[model samples]
Target: MALSRYDGCGETKLDCVSPGGVCFDPRFVGGDGVTFYFHGRKDQDFCLVSDTNLHINAHFIGKRNPNLKRDFTWVQSLGIMFDNHKILVGAQKTSKWNDNVDHVVMSFDNTTISLPPNEGSKWNSLVMPSVTVTRTSNTNGVMVEVANNFKVIATVVPITAEDSRVHNYNITDEDCFAHLEIGFKFYNLTDIVDGVLGQTYRRDYVSKTKVNVPMPVMGGQQRFSTSSIFATDCSASRFGLNTNRRDGVAEYPILHCSSGMKGSGVVCKK
Candidate 1:
């Protein structure tokens, strides 16, 4: 690794290029330090990561551009299934942008999670003590932790007029295209973990994305699409189904929730 010049602190900042981050039009930085794009279909679910005990799926929302072959998509929300429990987090929809108003929504096991609008304040699941959600800011930022499993830092944001103009997103006054910008830190991913980002963590994994391009778009939209936000039925899915037990019975449960942020804001389950 090369050292940064005194004023050139390129490595100090966090961007979509972080190996464990997902942001903006759904760009992903895999564990191998390679960046790629996966523009899944609008209003569909795609698996982001999958392992023996953890499965993460993202629901996409987007619009079509006349000139572009694909829909300009963003991860509208996330569904996480772990240790027989479920977590959901995402940005709420708004006709206009307002930082003063909270846009982040969260839920655990079908119950809404509401953290006070104060930085560092936190809420832990009563029945599931290993899980906790903390606010990183007064609004729009949060960190979810599952003890030894993983930690996720996420922020709610909207695509601005400038962003739409530059990228031709066609974002209209009816919606500001609010979505999530999230980062992951894994404490226990197996070598065989599989997904767009998960496969890069494998010990023997090799990147298939070309190195010459500035934006390397990953292929295989079909390989990662799930039936729904909480369905772990993607082709590459490895959540819980592979586990073996004394009775040889695997309990794979899926928790479904209504999309969109609503109802008295987010309130954590007591």
Candidate 2:
């Protein structure tokens, strides 16, 4: 079979360097999308993509052994924040890989949604606003689209012999150390837009920052923790007087009588 072409870089392994001590050396496959490679120690957070409105954060998982000469990393969770809303999709760890199941869970706005490890499963939410997630073609990754304009793609592949030999990673368990490839594509993005990696179309964007690190896996069907991405403003609520009240007397007593927490006894008259 003929070798595939990736981003016109041929079949070579493109080194992807980012902050937070992570590196991705991925083979280029022909596509208009930009791919990110992450290889590093476990329990570390890498800011994959960050812009004015969107932020993509990845969390890696694996055993942290200082005595071992070789370490492996796997993608445990992907956190995406669009505007003020955020969503997190993670893979559940299992004692062993199951051919018949795909254990995945998603959390948004303090709500958890789970889907059986089956192909073609999808999740849509209006409450979260303007994002849809679908399982990957191979049921190992996820494709996320926001407002039908921006796309985020994530996939996992086993480290090739070339990669292991080139990086000198001791292969203990083939499944333990997998390569995570993330790609980003925006529709009609203007040249002036700046992000964490700078303008998405710039030719020298990926090579601007470089970091070399030697690394980092997930199992079980447990749900990962969720966090709010929006900043909160502490503001006091002002209750307005109802014009339909009979006698024109303010019914402020009803507000205090409501169950749960107690409110101030003072009431403003209209």
Candidate 3:
């Protein structure tokens, strides 16, 4: 979502305008589908997707602009932490956007998936489950999703604007950048879940973490990077479990905790 300022009277004040006199600010603008606008060069992390089963953080690359007296930022990479696996997917540096080449790289649990840039490339495992890389209909973006589920996990779309060029800001290179949009939907998720971003489908849920980190750098070089480290402390609440029996009697199985209990296993509770 685009960031905007409110006056003392609680009215939004116009910040920047495009060459066509269009007021431009960080905002989530649209009806059916919306685009989030973010300013860059903050050494902070934004948790775009946070659920009991999934945690995705968007690291924005930001640089300062003395002429504009503001920081211009773009999403550099996404840090996805799910189950017991951690993956990082990001675009390589480029001077302009290319529709043919896939500059994205995905690292699964410290092992990089070495595959040529093509459609229908898939990655699967017990820890991270299934991930498929495919080209968008317009061939201008990349769509990463869960295999056979038809649910999009993440996306990279090209940024188009006359003022969006690298020369307009204090970036280290003259390459253009793209925006990152993510939607996290895990399989077999229960209602009672806890996360930093809260439940994905809950209307009243709000993100508990901050999206922007304000770190002033001279040029437009990335200030910080995310590691492969991740944690899966998620546990479904037992209160949501069905324990009522027709005969008015219920039984609960004793849980056996072992060193490897953190891994996948089915628990039988009667």
Candidate 4:
């Protein structure tokens, strides 16, 4: 895979630097092992990965760059749908950077969730034991999981004053542009998976980005756009189309994930 230095993501600890990562300025390390950027418009929602029993959409937020034709967007939140469930993980808007604060937010099936700002703290859904949210750090980091189907490891971060000065982002004192840096892992994706990142996992899929350039990017914005963050209406969406569901409900694998000495508290099987 040919790659130009400028087309790559910025280095950040615990960021999904691996193939499934999404980081600085919305750069992605696709499943094909290629690094690229996708500047979906701020205030819009786009599909990242979609498969038969799973669908993931991202909500973007950013400030328009005066020097560029496009906005410098970041992933503000994730909207996920599987079977009859809807889950959300997002970064709360903030005016200043505070490492001591917890700014991550989450919801399950429309019910808001709260967890202690202590490392290793966790919450389990009594309605569905298979679903869980665990704090990967004392603040601003989390791991959300659904058995063996998928996991989203995320951390809430703010664009520092230095970033604003260097990038000329015109960030204001009232909004520091707090956003999420996330990585994903999928265990049982089908062959028909499709979306910005999902397509790269396909055995026969070919990337359309110019990898050798300074900034490679994936196109076809319209195909991945969704009306709402949780809507499974993207054109390339393969979610909920599986025949394996029973009575319109999907059953997932019973595997589990844990944390310890590897991968920065990422999903590790129990």
In model 1, which runs have C-alpha deviations exceeding 4 angstroms? 1-15, 241-270
Worst 10 residues of 3 by lDDT: 14-23
lDDT of 1 by residue, 14-35 (tens): 2343456688888776665556
User: By lDDT, who's the top model here?
Assistant: 4
Ranking by TM-score: 4, 1, 2, 3
Residue 212 Cα positional deviation in candidate 1, in Å, after optimal superposition? 0.9
Give the TM-scores of the predictions, in the order they appear.
0.84, 0.51, 0.50, 0.84
lDDT of 4 by residue, 61-136 (tens): 9988778889999999999888899999999999978899899989999999999888878899999898989887
Every model: Cα RMSD to truth: 11.0, 20.1, 16.3, 8.2
Segments in model 4 whose C-alpha atoms lie over 4 Å from true places: 1-13, 243-270
lDDT of each: 0.76, 0.41, 0.39, 0.78
lDDT of 2 by residue, 1-270 (tens): 011123442212212221111224321111112222334446655444444444555566655446664245666666766655777766665543443454455677657865445545677886755667766643565666676345555554455556557755544443434435554544423223332222323333433212121110111112111122222110210112122212211111222111111211111121
lDDT at residue 17 of model 4 (Cα atoms): 44
RMSD of 3: 16.3
Worst 10 residues of 1 by lDDT: 248-257
- The Cα error of candidate 1 at residue 9, in Å, is 19
Against the true structure, candidate 2 has what lDDT?
0.41
Full candidate order by lDDT, most accurate first: 4, 1, 2, 3
